[model samples]
Target: MMGEAARERRQFWWFMLFALLVIGAGIGLRAPWPADEPRFVLVARQMWESGQWLFPHRGSELYSDKPPLYFWLLGASYALVRQWNIAFLLPSLLAALGTLTLTYDFARRSWNHRVGLWAAAAVLFSFQFVYQAKRAQIDPTVVFFITVGVYGIGRHVLLGPNWRWYWLGCFAAGLGVISKGVGFIALLALLPYALMRWRGWNGLSEPAPRGAGKWWLGGASFLLAIALWFVPMLVTALVSGDPEHRAYLNDLLYRQTATRYVSAWHHHAPWWYFIKVILTQWLPFVVFLPWLLGPWRQAWRQRDARVWWPLAWLLLVLLFFSASPGKRDMYILPALPALAWAAASFMPALVQRRGLRWALWVFSMLLGVGLLAVGLAALFGNPGYEARLVAERGLEVGSGALWLWRVLALMGALIVIAGIVCRLRHVLLFTALGVAVTWLGYGFGIAPLLDGESSSRDLMHEAREQAGADTVIGLVNWREQQLLQAVGPVTEFGFKQPEDEQWRRGIAWLQAEPTQRVLLSQDVAMPDCVDRGQIHPLGAANRRSWLLVDAQAVAGCR
Candidate 1:
C-alpha cells in the first residue's frame, strides 16, 4: 500500500502538469494582443530599454495608470530570457502556477489531499481563470499575491497561532497592493476570523492571546513589501524636480488608485453586473452551485472556520467590486480561489450526486453544440456575420478564416463526443476533459491563426515594406501593437496626446524629409490638411483602418 505522502506528491505534480498544459501551452505562439496586453508589454519593453525602473512610459508620455511592480516583473523576465514574446508573458504564467500551487497546498492542509486536488482543479478549469492566466495581464499576478495572502492568513487562523505564516500572508498582500492597488483585499480574511472567534467557532486555533505586537508585525511586513517599491520611487520622484515625474507620482498615487475606484471613467455597468459575471464567466465550477447551497448552509450553521473564512472573503471581494460604479469581468478573478476552496470542501460528495453529474453533462453538451454551430456557420456558409468578422479582423478568407473555424469545429466535435461517451457515470471527468480541450484548442490552435492580424503584425509588416528599409515612419493615433511590431525606424508623436496635436506633429515629421519619411494614421485621425488622393490605405487591423501618407498628401492648411 502506498503511503499518503507519496500519493499526495504524485497528485500534486499531476495537477501542476495539467495546469501548465492549460495555461502555458501557447506562451511563444503569439505576440501580445490589444485591449491591455500591448500597452503593458510596450511599457515593459521601454523600461527594459531605457533603464528607467521608477517611471514607466507609453510612447513619449508618462504611464501612471498602474503601479510599477508588474512592469518590473516584465522587465526582469526580459532580462532573464531576452525574448520579448516569451518574456512579456512569463510573470503572469509563473504567477498563475504559483497560485495553483498555493491553492492546492492550502486545501490539502486544510482538509485533505482529495479536497486540495479538487479545489485546484476547480480553479484551473474555470473559464475566467484560464482566460486571464493565458494572457499577459496584471490580474493574474495580483490574483496570485492575493491568494498567497489568503493561504497564509487562513493557515494561521485555522491551523495554528503560527505568526510566521500570518506575517507572510500580510507581506504577500502588501506585494499585491504594489502589483495592483487592491492587494489589501487579502487582509479581509481576518474580518471573518474575528467574527468566527466571537461566535465561538469550532476548528480554530486554540484560543491564545496573540500580543498586539504580533498583529503590528503583520502590518509592518505588508508595509515593508510596499516600501520596497514605494519608498525609492517616491523619494526619486519628489527630489527629481521633473514635472513629468511629479505628475506620474500624483496620478499613480491619487487618480489611478483611489479616485479611479471611486469614480470610474469607463466600462461602467449596473451593480448587478458582477453577479452576471459570476454566473457566466465562472462556469463549470458554478455548474455545481445548485448542489453546493445546502452543504454551504450546513457548514455555516456548524460554524466551520475553514469554510467561513474563504467564503466570507469571497463575499467581501464581490461586494467590493460590485459597489464600484465601474466594473470589468476580470475584476472578480481574485475571489475565484476562495470560491474554489469553499466549493471543493463539498465537491467530493457533490460529484457523486446524480443531479450534479447530469447538470455537468448538460452544460458540456450546450457548450459543445454552441461551438459547433458557430464553427459550422463560419466554415460552410458565407453568412453576413462571418463576412463582417473576416473584414473587421482583416483575416485572409482563403486561409486564416478557414483554419480558425476548422479548429473550432474540431474542438467542438471532440467535446460533444466526450460528453456522450462519458455519460452520467463519468460526467465529472467529461467536464474536466472538455475544459482542457477548449483552452488547449484556444492556446495552440485558434490564437496563432488570429495572431497576425490581431497583433497588428501584418499591418506593420506592410507599412514597413511600403516605406522601404531607409524610410522613417511617424505614427499618429497608433496603437501599441504597431509601435511594438515596427521593423525599421519608427517614431510616435505621443500615445496620450490629443488627435490634433498628434496629427500636427506627424505632419511636421513627415515634411522634415518627405522623400525619406512617411506617416501612418488611423482613418479617424486623418487631418483635413492631408490630400486624400495621395494617401494610401494600409488595410485594417484591430478593427481600425490605417492610412500611410507622404508630405505630398499635405495639401495647404497648417
Candidate 2:
C-alpha cells in the first residue's frame, strides 16, 4: 500500500494539472475584447514597438489609470513569445497558477496536505477567481503578489518570528501596491497577529526581539519595492519637463490613488455591495459557509491562532474596501486567499455532509438547466432577445450563431452528466468537474465564435476593405480594439478627445478627398452634417453600431 506522503504527492500533481487545464485554455483563440483588455494590450504593444516603458499610451493619450508594472509583464511576455495573442493573456495565466501553488503550500504547512489540496481546488473553482484568471486583467497579478505577502507574514507571525519572511512578505505587498495600489493589504495581517499575541493565542511563534529595528526592516523592504517603480517614474517625469508627463505623474499619485479611493468617481455602490459579491461570486466556497461557521467558532474557542489570524485579516480587508464608497466587485479579491486559508481546514469534513452535497447538486443542476434552456431557445424557438443578441454580435443566423448555441448545449449536457455521475459519492468533485467543463467549453468553443465581432476585428477589417488598401481611414469615438485591429494606413482623431471634436476632425479628413479617404465612427458620434443615407453600414461591434462615411456623406458642412 502506498504511504500517506506518496498519496498526497500524487494528489498535489493531479490538482495542479486540473488547474493548468482550466486556467490556460483558449489563450490564443481570441483577440483582446473591450472594457479593459484591448487597452492594456495596446499600451504594452506600444511600449514594445516605441521603446517607451516609463509611461503607457493609448492612441496618443497618456494612459494614467494604472501603474506600469502590469504592462511591463505583458511587454516582457510578448518579447518572449513574439505573439500578441498569447503574450497578452500569459501573465494572468501564470499569476493564477502561482496563486494556486502558494495557496496549496501554505495550507499544507499550516494544516495538512489534504486541506491544502482542497483549499487550492476551492479557489480554482471559484467563479470570479477563474473568470478573472482567464482574462488579461491586472487583478490576477495583484492577487498573486498579495498572496505571497500574506504567506510570508503568516510564516513569520503564526509559524515563527522569522524576520526575513516578514520582510519578504512586505516587499511582495509593495509590488502588489504598484500593480494596483492595494499591495499593502497584505501587511494588514500583522494587526491580527498583534492582537493574537496579546491574548496569548495558541500555535503562535515565540516572541521575537523587542526592538523597533526589526519592524523598521520590513517597512524598508516595502518602500524598496515601491521605489523600484516610483523613484524612476518620478525622476523621469521631472527631468523630461513635458506637461503631459507631469500630468500623468500627478494624476497617478494623487487622483488615481488617494483621491479615487476617498471619493470614488465611478462604480458607486452601497456598503452591502461586497456582501452580495461574497455570497454570489465566491460560490461553491460560499456554499459551505454555514458549515464553516460552527467549526470556525470552535477553533476560536480553542484559541487557534492559525484560524483567528486569517479570519481577522479577512474582516479587516472587507471593512477597508467597504468603507470606500466606490466599490468594484474585484476590489475584494485580494482577501480571497485569507478566506481560503481559514476555510481549508474545515473543507475536508464539510464535503461529507448530506445537506451540503444536496445543495451543490441542486446548484449544478440549476446552472446546467439554465444554459441548456437558453441554448435550446436559440437553436429552435427564435427568441426575440436571442435574435437581437445575434444582430448586436454581428453574427449571421446560420454558422456563427449556431456554433455558440451548440457549445452552450454541449457544456450544459456535460455539466449535467458530471453532476449525476458524481452525485453524493463525490459532490465536491462534481463541482470541480462541472466548472472545468464550463471553462473549457467557453475557452475552446465560445470565445472563438464571438471573437470576430466582440473583439472588433471584423469591424476594423470591414472598414479597411471598404476604404481600399491605399486609402487612409480615420476613426471617431474609437475604442482601443478598433485602433489595435485596424489595418494599413489608419488615423485616429483622438481616443480621449471630446466626441464632437473627434467627429469634426474625422469629417474634415474624409472631406479633404471624396473617394480617397473614409471615416469609420460610432453611430452616436456621427454629426448632423453627415448624410445618413450616403454612409455605408459597417455592422455592430462592442454593442455599438458603426458607419463608414466618405466625402459624399458630408452635407456641405465642415
Candidate 3:
C-alpha cells in the first residue's frame, strides 16, 4: 500500500474527474431559461442563421449590450451541436475547465504539486465559482482569459523575467477586452507588481532587472489584438454611414466600461455590495479567508514575491470591481484564482495545531447534526416546499416533484454522514465533496422541475393553437425577455418597459391578415364588445389575449 502522502498524491486525477462530472450533470437537462440564458442563446442563434460574424441581433434588432467574442464562441458551438441549450452552455463550461487548469498550473509553479491540486480543489468547490460555471453566462469565459493573463503576468514578474510570457499575457488581456467590456481591468492587476518592481521594493529586489525594452513589446501586442474588433466596426460605420453603428462602437469603448462603472443602469448596489457578496456568496473559501491574512502579513514582512504577488493580485482585482456601481455577486469571479492561490499557499505549511483541529471537529459535528435534521425534514416533512410553492403560485406540477424531494433528502443524508465521519480529520475534503454532491443534485433533480413550471412553452403552443400557424403572434405589454419561448417567430407589441416597440404597429401587422393574436401576461380591461378584435381565453397561461379580427369573428364583425 502506498504511504498516506503518496496515496493522497495519487488521488489527484480522480478528484479532478469527479469535479467535472459534478459540474456537468445538468448542462443539457433544461431549456434555455429567462432572465439571461434564452436571450443570449437567441442572439447566438440569430448570428449563426444570418451568417453575420461581426454584429449580433436579438431577433430582428441589433443587440449591443456586450462585445462579440462570447457570442462568437457560442454561435460556433451551436452551429455544430444543432441544439440550443447544450451548445449555448458548453462555452462557459469549457472556460471553467480552462480556468481550473490555469489555476492548478499557476499554484504548482508557485508552490509544490500537492498545494496546486488543493488550489484547483479550492476553485472547484467555491460557491460562486461553481454557480457561474454551470450556467450559460459570459463571466466564466471572461474569467478564463483573465486567469490566463494573470498566470502569464505572474510568471513574468514574480518567478522569473520572461518576455514571451509577458507578451502572451498581453495577448490574453486583449482577448479579454473583446470578450467583455472591462476585461482590460485584469491587466491593471499588474500595476502593483510593476510599481513594486520600479521602486526596488520589498519582495521584488533579487529577480534581477528586466531585459531592455521588454515592456514596449507587451504593450504593442495588447493594443493590436484589441484593434481587431474596434477597427472593423469603425470601417463598417464609415462605409455604411449608420450613426447607430458608430454609437454602438463608442458605447463599447467608453460607456459600458466607464459610464456604467460610475453610474450603472442596472443591478445598482452600494460600494459595499462586493464586501457583502464576498462574505456571503463566496462560501467555504470565505470561511478560510481570515487564515489567509496571516500568510499575507508574513509575506509582506519577509518580502516574498511568490506569496505577495497573489495577495496583490487579489486586492487589486477586488478593489477594481468594487469601484464599479454595476455590482453583481459574480462580478468578482475573475479574482477567485488569486484568492485560491493565496489560500492554498498556507496549506503546504500548515502545522498540526491542536486548538484549530479541535474547533473544526466541533464545527463539523454541529453542521452534521443540522444537516441530518434538514434531511429528515426533506424526507418526511409535510407540505413539501416544492409542492407548497407550486400551489401558492397557481401552478401545476407532476409526480416528478416527489422524486426530487426524495433525491434531495438522500443527498442531505450522505452529506451529514460524511460530515460526521470527517469531523476530526480532512474536514475541508469532506465538506467539498458534500458541496459537489449537493450541486449535482441541484442540476439533475431540482433545476428541471423548476424550469418546467417557469417556461411558457405550453402557453406559446396554445397561442398557436387558437390562431392559425401563419397568424402573427405578438407579445403585447409582455417583456420580450422570454420571446425565445415562442413556437415560432413573434413580434413585440409593448413600449417603454425596456422590452419592445409600440402596440399599434404590431396590431397593424396582425390586422394586415385579419387572423392574428396579441398575448399579454397580465389581464387587460376589455370593452363589452371589441369590433376589431376579441379576447381569446388562455386560462392560467396568459392573463388576456386577443385575436386581431379572429377568423370566426372576422365575418361576424363585418
Candidate 4:
C-alpha cells in the first residue's frame, strides 16, 4: 500500500510536469495572431476604446459576424497588455489552460490519476489543439465551454442527480451559446447519457424518483442565460434605423448560418475531410480508439451511466460537426476532451499489455522525431537561395524562420527516444510520449510556421518608414489591402471603383508622385521612369516575404 501510494504521488507530479512542459513549449514558439484572431482582437479593442459593448468595429466599419462575449473577454485582456499583438492571445491561452484543467478533472474521476494525467497531456499536446489555442480565435473558447458543459453533465447524471451540478451545466451551455453558435451541440453530446439513464430506470423493479421538475428548472435557467445575449441583439436589429446595422443582422443571423448549412462558403472538402483530419490530428491516441470500443460496449451493457455520458458527448459532437456545411480543422476541437476521457479509460489496460504498449511508444516516438526534424530544418536551414530569388524577382519570401526546422528536429528526436524508453520500462510511458510529442510539435514545429509568416509585419514597417508620416497610402489590390492593413493604414483604392477608372487612377497616382515610395504587389508592373531603380525585397522575420519599391525610382522612370 505504501509503495502504491508513493507511485501514485510520483505519477501525479509527472503528469503536472508534462502539462507544464506542453504549455511552456507552446509559449516558446510564439507568433502574432493570424487572420481571425487579429481581426477579432481589433474589433474587441475598438469596442473597449470606443465604449460600445454591443456594436463591434474594425477601424470605421461595423464588425458583427460573431457575438461580443469573446471580444469582451479579449478586450479586458487587452486592457492589461496594451499591445494588440500579445494581448489578443490571452483568451486563447486561458481557454487552453481551462481545457487542461477540465480534461484532468474528467479523466481523474472516470479512471485513475495516471489516466487523468495522460488525458490532460494528450489535449495539451494534440497538434490541432496546440495550433488553435495559440491563436486569438474563438474555437478554444467554444471548446472550453463545451468541456465545462460536458463535465457538469457528467457529474450531474453520473454521480447521482445534483441540482447544483445541473445548474452549472446550464450555465456552461449558456456561455457556450454566447461564445459561438454551437452551444446546443453540448446537449446533443449528452443524449447518450439520457438514454442510458432512461434504460437504468426501466430495469429497476421500484419506481424511479420523479425529477422532471429539476430538469425543467435547469433547462429554463439555461434558456434564460442564453436569452440575455440573443434577445438584446434581436431587439437592436429590429429597432436600429441604419441600413448597415440591419445588414449586419441579416448577414450574421440568417445569411452566415443559412449559407453555411445550405451552401458551402469556403471549405467544401469531401465528406471524408474531417475523417482524415481526426485521424491525423489525434495521432497516437487515434490508435487507442479500438481499445475504447470494447469498454464502451461493456459500459453500455452494464448500463454504466458514468462512462456512457462522455462517449455520447464525443459521438454527438463528431456527428454534429460532420453534418455542418461550414467546417474547418478547428471545428472538431470540442469533441477532443470527451475522446480523451474515453481514451484514458483504457490507458491502464493498454499499459498492462507489453507488446501493445511497445508498439504505440515506438510509433509515437518516430512520428515525433520526424516532426522535430522538419522544424529544425526550417529553423536553421539557410533559405539563402530562396531569399536571393525573392530579392532578384522583387518578391517577398513569405516563408519564415530557418531555425524552426532545427527546433522541430531536436524535439522530434527527443520524443521518439522518450517513447521507446517509457515503453521498455512499462512505466507511465504514454504520459512521457504525450509530453514529448506535444512540446516539440507545438513549440518547435507550429511556432516556427507562425514566425515565418512575418512578411506582413515587415512590409507594414517599411511602408510606414518610406511613405512618411503624412503620406496617403493606397493599395492596388485586395491582397495588398490585407497585407497593408495588417501593418498600418493604407487606403484600399480599387474596392469600390470601376475597373477602368480604378486602374487609370492608380497609374496616374503612381506617375504623379514617382518620388513618393508606394507599395505594390509583384503582379503590378512598375510605371515608366527615366531612371528606374531596383525594387527592395522585404524579408519576414519568420515565414513569408514582400517587396518594397523606391519612390525615387518610380519618379525617375516617368
Question: Which has the higher lDDT value, candidate number 1 or candidate number 4?
Answer: 1
Give the alpha carbon lDDT tens digit for every residue of 197-259 in model 1: 888998788864389999889999999999998999999989989988899999998999888
Report lDDT (Cα) of residue 434, candidate 3. Answer: 70
Question: Candidate 2's C-alpha lDDT?
Answer: 0.89
lDDT over C-alpha atoms for residue 99 of model 1: 92
Give per-residue lDDT, candidate 2, residue 508.
75
Task: Pick the TM-score winner.
Answer: 1
Worst 10 residues of 3 by lDDT: 540-549
Task: Arrange candidates, best TM-score first.
Answer: 1, 2, 3, 4
Q: On residues 502-533, what C-alpha lDDT tens digit does candidate 2 reach at each position?
A: 88887777777767888888888566777888
TM-score of each: 0.98, 0.97, 0.87, 0.80
lDDT of each: 0.89, 0.89, 0.69, 0.64
Tens digits of lDDT, candidate 3, 325-382: 7888888888888878877868645524554555444544554455556546645665
lDDT of 4 by residue, 1-558 (tens): 899979877876676665556554554244454557546766776688788887776655676667778988888877887766566677877788888888887777666677788788667657788677766789889989878877777666665456687678777888888777776677675567556656662222123324778778768867876887778877887797878778777777776665666776787666667888888886656666666677778766776544656666776777767776667888878888887876676666765676656656666666776676655544556546535533443333444334434455666777766765665664345545555566556665655554434324445666677667656555553342243244545554544345444445655676666555365433334344413346655444223444555454445432
Give the Cα error of residue 490 in candidate 1, in Å.
0.8
